[model samples]
Target: MVREILRVTNISCGCNKVMVTVEDGSNFIADAVIITMPLGILKANFIEFEPKLLDRKVTAISDLGVGNENKIALRFNNVSYPCLYGSRAFVYDLEKLSDEFAANFVML
Candidate 1:
């Protein structure tokens, strides 16, 4: 059965068994426990294990981080670049653009 888990604690990993205490104070045992929490949550130390996790494991988790970059590509119809300019791409400073200039884009 798939259950909604609020928290996990008292994890004990032995030769062939894995036991954990759920938020409701119920004990659950399984062959393995798959923790799919996000890196951010894992870094927060939400779960408390019976035997504290190894320093190397904690170090690895702390060393992990995520980054993202957003990009936008624009294509203008009925537009041509001068051969002397030799480029079809134009970069704009959005903050520098006036509201009127930005409004023209919404019409497209």
Candidate 2:
């Protein structure tokens, strides 16, 4: 299998042209471009374009919220708890009950 890779840097936007500096320090231009990057990076102002983007697009981008989630995996050395049939043990807090809870052990 063959893999093709392109590395672009020093991106700049003009009235009708998109300029970029390649790995070899050569300049390249394009007419129209579509950028598909993480919303967080765009919000951080890491990449700058010559001409600002559309107001709607900017608003849409700013309105977006990105979050970080973590998944944990646990392995018990021994099964100390007893299980009967299909019964399961879960922890809950009555004072902090949330509407997002659809099931006993499920959280949204």
Candidate 3:
């Protein structure tokens, strides 16, 4: 347990613990985990989340005032919890991710 974690692919907060998956398909679970990657890395979107982050959070991290290229928003009016559509905004499905990836996770 003395090696460095590289190529983190996904991080999920399940039940009362955190689960981290690496590019090598290794899984690590813990009470809590900390990520110290730089802002640039975050903007690059090299990693993915089980419950994908909302569009707003994604925009904030990826924006960097680079323009609309970073914003990715898909809309579905026929679906429930329709927040924004056809805009440069991102929204997550509550029923899909549950508390694991709440839309307002950043607020917490």
Q: Candidate 2, residues 1-108: lDDT per residue as tens digits?
A: 211344444578767787866556776678855556677878776665556667898889889899997999878897533332332323334224454442442431
Per-candidate clashes, comma-separated: 0, 0, 1
TM-score of each: 0.53, 0.41, 0.51
lDDT of 3 by residue, 28-84 (tens): 898888777767667887777767889899977766644334766878666454455
Runs in model 1 lying further than 4 Å from the true structure: 66-108
User: What lDDT score goes with residue 10 in model 3?
Assistant: 87
Whose TM-score is greatest here? 1
Clashing pairs in 3: 55-90
Worst 10 residues of 2 by lDDT: 81-90
Candidate 3 lDDT score at position 19: 88
What residue pairs clash in candidate 2, if any at all? none
lDDT of 1 by residue, 1-108 (tens): 455655775687877988888777998888887766667777888777767889999999899985675998998786543223323333344334577765674455
lDDT for every model?
0.69, 0.60, 0.70
